[model samples]
Target: MATRTSALKLLRSSLQNESADFRENQWEAIDLIVNKKKKLLVVERTGWGKSSVYFISTKILRSQGSGPTVIISPLLALMRNQIESAERLGVRAETINTSNMDDWDQIKQAVIDDQVDALLISPERLANEKFVSTFLEQIADRIGLFVVDEAHCISDWGHDFRTDYRRIINILKMMPNGMPILGTTATANDRVVDDIVGQLGEVEVIRGPLTRESISLQNIVMSDQSQRLAWLVENIPNIPGSGIIYTLTKRDARLVSKYLNENGIHVAPYFAGAEDDESTSDEHREKLESMLLGNGIKALVSTSALGMGYDKPDLGFVIHYQAPGSIIAYYQQVGRAGRNIDDAYCVLLSGKEDGDIHDYFRKSAFPSVHEVELILGELENSDGLSVPSLVENINLSKGQIEKVLKYLSVEDPSPIYKERTKYLRTAVDYQLDTEKINWLMQQKTVEWKEVKDYIWYGGCLMNYLQEVLNDEIIEPCGKCTNCLGEAIFPVEVNHRNILNASAFLKYSEFYVQPRKQINKGALKEYSIPSKIPANLQSEGTWVLSKWGDAGWGHLVAEDKHNGVFRNELVKAMENMIIHKIDPSDFPAWVTCVPSKRHPELVPDFAQRLADSLRLPFYPCVKKIKDTNPQKEQQNSYFQCVNLDGAFTIEGEIPDGPVLLLDDAIDSGWTFTIIAALLRLEGSGPVHAVALTSTAVN
Candidate 1:
């Protein structure tokens, strides 16, 4: 019953523009989904109106008495944008995500009563037993259409593959035959496309050229973080309009945002906040997105969490603080710029630390053979184990345990099944796919190499991106640095700006938050309570730098290897503590976290620091037993267990607050145990300080 004219009318209504029409193949996609009830894959570039196809299709299908469409979206931001877009065309759309748990029952009832036209849910919801039973199963038979936004994630070969997306294929297998299904993305390469097609079975493919004529691409190399920060302070103000600045890590996102703000630029740092952290809640991210869209901020310094399905048509620029790990990811991120504008800029700033960060991500992406075997063995022995129980027993972090379980439970003839809150092993013997994992690692290496090549490519940066993505049509854009034979932004940074940036990095300090609770059964001999007693805990710790990072981090690293802290390092620490710490919180005396491996290293530094602070020094804490380095213990339980009975308080107790100093801090368990010991011996409030933090922020 849907025709091209009716689709166009609906599109115009959605866009609020009477003259707007479908781009090439848009109508064909709608026809396949609505008229023929066929599964379709649309691989078009950004701004090609992919959402219009599904919105219009949902309208046609609902009018014909089909069930409401269910779209498995990836992000809350994406869902909000889609719901708004759907509303413009008179399509009633609602979402059920983590942020709105209380509304699930009402939304489900609305779907059952045929009051809702479309439903958007995250991919993780498909794996939730309660959601599947209470909502999805109730309306499975009459469901009109199923949509997968960011479909490339369904394939492990994709640049941003997520384990939760594999659940979509299982849902697809259970769908009734001839039901309309749609998979859409703008960044899938040929290999990722093939993998997705194989997963979806036979489906109509609509592919298009992946070129953005509106964006001018360039690559600039900076040797260090300070230079990059200086460049941003100088150049971002001169850019055409508000946009996004991408960082590879959350720490850099915050660091860049802080530096830019200090220099009078309006910006905010955005990343996937820790679970239950209200500052980075769904509402907060939505607010930031709205601010960017409204041009209230200059740009958002963000991680890849802001990458997919974020809709903003007139964004003017996207500057990368470091090169992304792959060209596919680069294209997807940069594509966010110039969606509806005539001119925008896409710049990549290469750094020395890019390769190291990429390597860390690549190596940790998959569970190792040993790790998988250990988890399966434990599950095989027990009746069942919850995630927390597994974390307490296994040496793996909670994240690693969850990843392994999710991967195993999604297998055909799955080796495990979840009952209530625990995962139980099945009779099926699971075999590790070493070959496939190795191949994937090799693929990642190749992708990273391609990114490096892109930085130095001679022909055209946009052309290189298109070719890497296997775009149907690739040609020189005549708009990149290679095409223009020069850079668009000034390569040289102001000397004063660099000095200011370096000083800012040097003075930045991060607090080492004390652990409030001990893992159950971790210190059975010590009889420590689950909730650490507040009175016995250290006030907190201040880390002067991140290990081997900007500012004093490199000096800390160098000093540690040379077996002595430099005088300049001590002076810097003294200056930082004086300026950064509250006067009332200053310690009355100083002590060192005793180290058996290098006993003199920390003690010598502590003694000098005590002299500089004009406070009495005490060799109060003694290492009673040698233990494994805290870094070797991957999880909290193991880290706590390793330090049990490892230290004891020696010498006379101090009456006033004490400064506990260490060369480097990781896990913060050493300081916690030491502080508790000092507190038990009648020492005053313990203030902890460290030269640097070894853990990645």
Candidate 2:
């Protein structure tokens, strides 16, 4: 048994809680872990001291000559928090993650030399070829207590289900017998709990209320994206302190951050695959994370890339620019606020585009039947292949291919296995798991409705969220904006702020951050050079607004569909050419990239723009063959390949300084191909212009 004095001493040291004893539930969990040596599950609230149960138990068990604890956390942010917590408790901890590869060798040596106590790693590290081959086997028998953090992801029924987490059960199953195991999560409904319980086998379960008394929740429903943008500009300063502003996509993250910065808010945009100024180094991710910890910046305009396991105890607020897809995700994100404060805000600024954004994510969330078959068939025919190779043969995006492989690798008695670098097919025949697929889709539907309920339910927002998580809302919590009938957010729009926001969004300039490298192994068929020449590439492309959005974006969309742009667009482009673009670089002639589908639209626009400038107009590029629409193809590399050999210069090459016109630039490959062709025909210096841009990431 863990002595009361020892546990309290550890708690005081680790959390500075000043408590003389553990909470009843925490003690129960520790007792089962230390004395009983029984596996346990802790489904607790965000601030319920879940880490203390494991940290205290690790100390107790280590004293009894148990091996070092191995924790499979779901995020690098979580691992960082756990390591810090462990340090506070006087336990030596180190982590091996994607972010810190140079230190991995030293960390591994420390573990082998018995100089480390607790070791934290991301769940996806289990599937890492180098780590699995080099570290996992050696550490398998040395794990005294194996902990799975954010265990909710193991359940397909869970709102934030990840395919990688399901593989943790297999790791657990493969571990030495009688190893004490623990799974911890903050959000899980009845179905999710049952699913996790089934996977973990017989274990002690300690569940608690899904409530945070300190957080005041509210849904400030805005009429449009513009209103939401304006609301953020006006209200963010009014909100108490530094926090996170969550967006649905990376593009929005950048735009929101840009707007806030222009308004003197001093925020940063954080997202997955975000890099340093050179767009190669991952240092920016580390820097942003540090900024949040030190409160060096007011907030991070972020996508879900900033979500999951980031610990900021005194975080003052969490504002969702767009509502998340489900109660599970929303609660998890909003919970980041008020961890150590009494009155923090959890506000959701719901826009009309929220549902559309949610649906887009859902559609790409899983691989279809045909995608699975494509992967399995390719593997069956070869000895082995890697993800990059699979991307060349299979038309799926690198992300989609990797996702499919991740799903396949989690299957029990898995039919696909990786040896060293390449993944190989097992002897077993591959077949789609229709049952599992249907179940996953059904769960997504439930989650979609779950978000709607939170937005529309005419009761306490916190209570609604708790009930949605399968916990009883005993009474209305007056802490929420719904029950209190007030919020920190203002009741009406600020017209001046609205005008500024509209102007900011209206002239938002997105450049063609062109592809730095060609998609590997598919170059031979295109007859194009392996390397892109600098002169042929688009010097710059302007995105005046977002697609299907407010202000200029709406105008662009109507223009795209109606095949005619308004005079406002003409003036915006004219202003961009006059002020933003250099006069010496102005095009002597305007040429449009022909689209077989929208053949007349872009060409007509180019003519109008040239007429406005009194420059020559020519359709210098022809769509020689019918090809798949770039939007229909999700893979950027495939979009590049799809565009190759599909365009040819038409009529005579335009004279010096040709401007390339297009409706929108998604992959930027269209402009790349057309510009290359024009430059090859001795056309003058090429510049590209587009109405809008989508995030390449």
Candidate 3:
């Protein structure tokens, strides 16, 4: 036999055992260590097989026979996923966690005695006094390597922060000798990497790019509220795979999940603050796990509660019903898909109002020191406290309470936590008197009628409340189905079929669906309100009004750009009722020229707009449309964009009323702007309408 060098033999065997999931990019990382003798901190984007680095490293370390390896995991669910994968490969790996409460001593003994090759422990357990004391005293010198999973938590700026991370450096200090450190996380940013290195004291940085070439990202700017529901109904069936639909609130998560399930797409919903009806925590977890792993449930809708721990690599899509709090949040939420390096898509269905809604839900500032003191004071005597009890005792709002709890559990240094988990409120086997506890489950429903009413009849308050508060019972509407009549199943109705029927009925509704082929409103009547909807020529089309012409090119609303406008609109519309503006001013205010394509309909359309706006001029439709010529009187019907070309101020000209125009009333942006300006200029309230309402799209 030829004398083979050790490196040559190892290379030959490695090539022969190449894995299907391995990529050249992965090898580049391993090569830095194996060939260059450089300790690496490899960071790969989400779904890029970052786990392979360690799996391969395990063999390299075993061959070296230095010592056993240790992995620190953030969540028990995550630990299980990795442990199961290792077990299947005949790798001896085990995890220690609060889940195995009774066997903590046994697991600790294994780590001290070196009975385990690879051990996984939750961050909380790693910080445990008993665990830390034992590891520092006995096992500190035996460690081969340290793996920090979800290392992004080390950064205070990151969305998911773990307080336990602050002590990770301290733990490492207890180690007998310096060892190469690996920080792994899918959602690491520059800020996170800096924080990790700074906290760990000594570390090498290996950051992977955030871009995933295998994934496609699209932002769908829907025309109206109903279009989101319609898009799901139409496309969900064609693209069949497990997907996660993220919503801003639990109510929206539940409603969206229900709507998808109703439309033949079986969906399961996970919410942050939902009540569990099961008798045990395991039962609740089992039920949720069954729904996630079982067949037929192809989609799961949830809030951020589903973001941190869950892993199912074959996800086909992640749809954000609303924009997340930050771009980082947006990235992390969408990163859930394409984990297998397979083709997948992430679509964000955003609107002009998304940022405003996000602001309404985001924690505005850090929890005050006083607030934290109050919380600790309340819980000082108790071994553990439920969320509701904590909220009540601390006198903090529910939102504030949640933020505080998340901060304490994840972000704050030297945070206090109970060694207990909250299970469902236990029920007695004996029949007991039923009492309705002070539990409110707020929800919002997206039905054709509600969408239509919001666009055509309701004021800003109703629209704001409906969109912001869905699927939960926030406040009881005595008239709604759940309040008075019965709990209706959204499942009986088909969303797509309902939309198709509504589209066909547009003739009666004084609207027309743009032909599928002739987009850009080639027929003039079917044109979209915006410059041209990207999807118009492809699958669907809708009618738009004249104002859409200029309004479409205006700056898109975002939190950083148009927060002032949203705040002004919200403030002005807080107390006002919906009213229409006069028609005499409509002519100059009209942004797009009327179709003139319909000679017989000019006066008819004019009068319709006037009536919708409740304009005093052109009150007599017959007089305005009369063929006999009458000298027209001039009216103050124009509002001009400032000479500098900023948004035109809509107010009463010291001489008279000013006209405002818009393409449609989907979000009532135009109306809100005009209303705000008019209020500022002492012009009373705004009354306005479009050629047709665009809700129920």
Highest TM-score against the true fold, candidate: 1
Candidate 3 structure quality by residue, lDDT tens digits, 624-649? 11121111101101111110122233
Tens digits of per-residue lDDT for model 1, 45-80: 988988888999999899999999999899888898
> Which is the leading candidate under lDDT?
1
Lowest lDDT 10-residue stretch of candidate 2: 520-529
Q: Which stretches of candidate 3 lie over 4 Å from their true place?
A: 1-22, 25-40, 135-137, 222-226, 271-296, 308-313, 339-342, 351-357, 373-697
lDDT of all predictions, in order shown? Answer: 0.90, 0.80, 0.48
**By lDDT, is 1 or 3 better?**
1
* Rank by lDDT (best first): 1, 2, 3
Supply the global lDDT for candidate 1: 0.90
Model 3 alpha-carbon miss at residue 301, Å:
1.3
TM-score, predicted candidate 1 vs. hidden true structure: 0.98
Candidate 2 local lDDT, 595-621, one digit each (tens): 777777778777888888888888768
